[model samples]
Target: MIYLTTFLFMLLAYLFGGLNGAILLCRLKGWPDPRTRGSKNPGTTNILRFHHAQAASAVLIFDLLKGTLPVYLAYFFDYSPVEIGFIGIATCLGHIYPPYFQFKGGKAVATGLGTLLPLGMDMTGLLILTWLFTVAVSGYASLAAIVTALAAPFFVEQIKPEYTTPVIMLSILIVLRHISNIHRLLTGKEKKIVNWKQ
Candidate 1:
């Protein structure tokens, strides 16, 4: 029964993650599907690029909650840190490869950070600052994501060793999802930060 419950929670987490906020919100507003616009990535940045900041903020909050809910539930049920970590991973997988979206989904940046919120705010805050600093300095959101993914597991290892493996898995998954972005960066084709006024 314990195993069954755990599996069920993970499944729920994945389903929640599979709920693409950009896609859904765009649909709600009768706008173009985000997956078909801008960078063709259903994420906050893409929405902000083609749509408005208000829409982008909605997507960000929605994605963050999806990442936070499942893990928080697991923690509330007294699951171990390792179990919670796996649940977090499941949420990220859903975002990256959502079954509802025919296995095409966003890069899981907001959702991945959401999963960490239940574990410790300090780690999450550090990663957020890293992302902000990288984006501010480099003007490449994908670069910031890659750097954050690389840093996440290391931070977990130092503060919560039990969560390291799952965090590492999540990190690898995120980096892999950004492969095209990495290629763009190397080829000097990556999109830089867009001016909010323009």
Candidate 2:
């Protein structure tokens, strides 16, 4: 029974994760598919590039909720921390490669943050601060995301050791997803937040 319930939750979480808000709003407003515009990603950053801040904000909130709501349910149901980690990563993966979206989804930055904040507020706060600080100084959103994603496991290890192992596994996946950004940074062509203005 326990296994069955967990499996169902995982499935629901993945399908829900695939429902990208940016894609929906783009079509609603008659905007071109985000996948064919801007950075060509079905996430908030690309929406901001193709649309306006309001549209991007909506996408951000929606994506964040996709990660938050499902993982929170795992906690509310008293699942172990390890199980919660699995649920969180499931959502992230859904965002990265949602089927209905032709397997081209967002990079999962906002989704991953949404997934962890509720589970470990203090550690998540640190991660958020690190991201903001890095972006402010470096102006590279991808760099900030990479740094924080890499650091998440250590914070979990110290504060919630039981979650550490799975968190590390999830962190690896997130970092791996950022490989393109890493290469762009090395080539001095990575997009910065400031670039959004012009």
Candidate 3:
């Protein structure tokens, strides 16, 4: 029944992750859907374009929470590292392609951050720092994501070897998802974050 249990847990994790707080908030506020706005992405960055920074921050935190809680639940259940990683990946996938959003959802950055929380604080911290550094230096979310994803395999392998395969697979998927963004970035046409204070 272990396989069955794992599948059930993954399904539940996906359901939780699919709760797109940004889209919900936009609908409640009668604001334009973020997917139809700047960048055409249903994520915090796009939300910031349509609403206050506070609103976008709220959505980001909520999305991160959705990604985090599931993996924690799997850990609580005393699952194997592979199982936990599977659940974590499932959560990211759900956030990236939420059923509630008709399978069009946010990029998996925040969700990936959430999934890494249970792996270990040090590893999670490293990933966060790397992502922040990339974003700060490049101001391109896609670049940050790609750089962070490329760093994931090394981080997981060095710190959590048991999860290496899963982490590597996740990194591949995240990198693939950002391929279009990479192309735009190369062409100097990638969407840049606007200074909202003005």
The clash numbers for all candidates, in the given order, read 0, 0, 0
Q: How well is each residue in 1-198 modelled by candidate 3, as lDDT tens digits? A: 999999999998888888888888889889888888788877777787777989989988988888889888888989998899899889888888899889998778778877888888889899989988887777777788899999988998899899888888788878888888988988989976632344
- For TM-score, the strongest prediction is 1
Q: Note the Cα lDDT for every prediction shown.
A: 0.90, 0.83, 0.85
Tens-digit lDDT track of model 1 for 120-188: 888988899999989988888999999999999889888878888888988999999999999999999
Candidate 3, superposed: residue stretches over 4 Å from native:
194-198
Alpha-carbon RMSD to native, per candidate = 1.9, 2.0, 2.2
lDDT, candidate 3, equals 0.85
Clashing pairs in 3: none
The number of residue pairs in model 1 that clash at the backbone is: 0
Q: Positional deviation of 183 in candidate 3, in angstroms?
A: 0.8
Residue 161 in candidate 1, Cα distance off native in Å: 2.1
In candidate 1, position 85 carries an lDDT of 83
On lDDT, the leading prediction is: 1
Extract clashing residue pairs from model 2: none
- TM-score rank order: 1, 3, 2
